[model samples]
Target: MDKSAQTRRNRRQSATFFTLGLIFIVGLVVMLSNVYQLDGLTDTVHDRHAIRQNTRLRSLQQFQAAGGRGVVGEARTRSVCIFARDGPAILHVKAVFERLGYDIRATKDDDWDVLWSLKSPYVAFGERLSKLKPHQKVNHWPGLGSVTSKSDLATSKLLSAPVGYRLPKETDAFRAATKANPDKMWVVKSGTHRGVRVRKQVDNVLKIRHDANLFIQEFISNPFLIDGRKFDIGVYTVITSIDPLRVYTYEEEILLRFCSLPYHPFDEAEVNKYVVTADYTPTWEIPSLVEAYNNFQYSHKQALNLHLGRQGHNPKPMWQAISDSIREVMHAKEDGIREIVRKRFSHQNFFELVRFDFIIDEKLKVYLLEVNMSPNLSSGHFAPNKWLYEQIVYNTLKLVGLASATAAHPADVSKDERDMLVSLRDIQVASDRCASAECDDNCKPDICQLCQLCRTPYFTDSVKAAFLEHVNRGNYRRVIPKPLEEQPSTVDVSKAINSTQNNHLMTMWFRGKCEHDKTWCT
Candidate 1:
């Protein structure tokens, strides 16, 4: 009886132990398998991140290599011809170009890569500009005078510009405007001369000579003042293309020219109280901006924004308004500008640098006063402004493809340059395709007008330009062909077909680039 009972008890214990061991083995195998799967997933994510980083790095290298080749292509030595008569005013221009390793040539030097002239070269160098090579560039665009000239600007009647009338032709309109708003003061200015005089009485304007080539504009009496002094912002604007119309402003800093006298106790006779002449007050001279600009080393724009912020004003909207105003003026005048450019041998060889003088009212509303062609680049009047002028020139050159990130000349470019270089051919091969699955490679159908394959050379060039600019735009912000967020959600096919608005292509390209690299968003 004892032997039988003992055997049963042993069997029961053995079976129980065997079952527990099996369960433990299975749990261990599952835990190990899960750990392996987790590590594999992590490795896959890391590999993807590395690939993206490599792709971006490669893309940047390609852009840098392309920059090494001057915009006009592989040139051993780049030369800039200066036609500016204002000697000291353009010293910074020469200095910056020299810093970029450009040889400064006299106006007579016909062999030049860039023609940095005070006015449209079409007047004196018409034949040369008409024969402009693909690699050549000019600082002025034809027909820009329509908006730059005081009388022409008044006649253009740009919405951003103050109410204005060209003399003689619109004298009657000026009289009516004055009668309607008698309290508003007006400033009479010569089309060619920078001199401006406030005209309080309508009789004074009427008494002026009819053929004086003068432009009468409403005076912005209630100016937004800093330290009780009136001021105007000199925004350095650049136009790279005219057909599609690309415009940019130097966003890093702006030139702040404050009136020599306070704006209060208005005096029509005192020119210093209103006009920001060549002898205008500098930023360091303004009490509110002195500390930030001089001691804190804040840029003029930063200092101005800080001051405005402290005064309970949001500078963002003010700046955005300013940008919007600039875009509007360019868009409004594009047809005229394009018409002039079309007469040229090649529009691709031209670019422009102008200073848009803007005045702000007490309500922070921005008004375009004038567009100064070949803006004073010298800091001869204000020594501290030398840095600002140089930077503006340098950044402008970079943005326009006249300057490269590296100082190496084309001949000195490394043998490995091709590896890093992304040529136009490469871009075309990679990007020139229809996104629609149903479309053939040629994109021959009429509906394929928007396709990259069917896009005109102008459209393609615009996209290429936009890509290069996004890469090299250090502190400049593109205003025309507005930022993607500000554009309509859908492309305007009609505009694209007409090539009047290729901004959709640029916006799409920029959006993709921005997704890959946030820095491009700027």
Candidate 2:
């Protein structure tokens, strides 16, 4: 009896020990598997970061040695011809060459003597260059032209009217209208036949044409604003090649021009001059003040809204919404224009710099004001401010194969250069700033400019890794779960039927019980 009991006890103890050991081994393997998974994830993330770092390094190198050219030692020689209207815009172009150490001379025949056509100092031709117009011959060399006849080309007419168009000249009739309505805008015009002058005004501007037989558009009022201040959107697209006229880069810079309301205040002397001077218009007080008066008398409600507010009511404060709306519309139109070139003229590249003008209303609707093909870049309003223009010029040179490959990378860029880059990027972002709207506002260049300025190789690899790391540390990963695959559940008709029957029975029983025994006391 003792041996049998001993053997049974030993077997029970052995069974218990074996089961416990197996359980412990299973738990250990599970824990090891989890550890392996976590390590693998971390390693994968690190590898991704390394690859991104390598890519960014490569890009930086490419940017520095733009077009694979090393540093530019001196300006080179190149030949180019440009057609443009003689105006303030041309003066900016002249300044670009003078700064680059090039000789710029305006020729009687409407040609500019540019020093370095190939990485040399150059002049921005001050002629009206336009897309090939209807009923005009395609300009093959020196670019498009309005001068068809050899004699016309020989004359200043060709250069004076490159688009074969001219705006109206000032006249007595126009002066009278202007005198009658000094605040209101007026139009002037001129025409010619067989080189004979014939000028007159038509009721409709659309029907009128200048001496070059081309219509001249009147400058419209820009009513767009920012924080109730007047502003314009400058689409700075770079033309890397004019012969091919490829647009290499596209940027939108905002020019927020601060103008006081039509009637905030006027200097005492200025007001006295307007009041006492004979040259003063019927009511030459302050434009803003006059506008305020008109608004109050005609639209009392609007005047009240513009005058009464915590900010002391800005009657004609900057209109940011309108400014953006105008840019959005122009962006779409420019896309169409670019497409026409790509499809019609075989230009597939983007412009290096292009600036469009727009005005917006209180409702945020944009209106096309005018197109500034070449904006001013004078000393005060220099297009390339300190570091800002360096990027433009550097990027332009890079695109044209004039700089080193890594010209885009700003790491090696001088501190001053980097500051300008930062400002340019900041401008883009600031332009996209809106009180309430999607970031995709016409000022999307803001994001691109910032990315370039920060030298973050975009959101490709390193960016994603950094983001994930932050998310994990911040517990964001727990909130944002990985996507799961959708799986269809098999239907159990019998179960469903039974469940329905059970519910029906419960309801019927409850009703019957209520009818038979009100309180179920019995």
Task: Write model 1 residue lDDT over 52-169, tens digit each, in one string.
Answer: 8888777656756654333323347778898877578788888888878889887877878888886667778868788876667888788887768777776666667788887777
Provide the clash count, candidate 1: 1
lDDT, candidate 1, residue 108? 79
Question: TM-scores of the models, in the given order?
Answer: 0.77, 0.28
The regions of model 1 sitting more than 4 angstroms off are 1-75, 405-433, 441-450, 486-504, 511-521
What is the alpha-carbon lDDT of model 1 when measured against the actual structure?
0.76
lDDT accuracy of residue 423 in candidate 1:
41
- Which 10 consecutive positions of candidate 1 have the poorest summed lDDT? 489-498
How many Å off is the CA of 165 in candidate 2?
A: 13
lDDT string, candidate 2, 172-211, tens digits: 4444554564454222222221222112233443245445
All candidates: CA RMSD (Å)? 18.2, 27.7
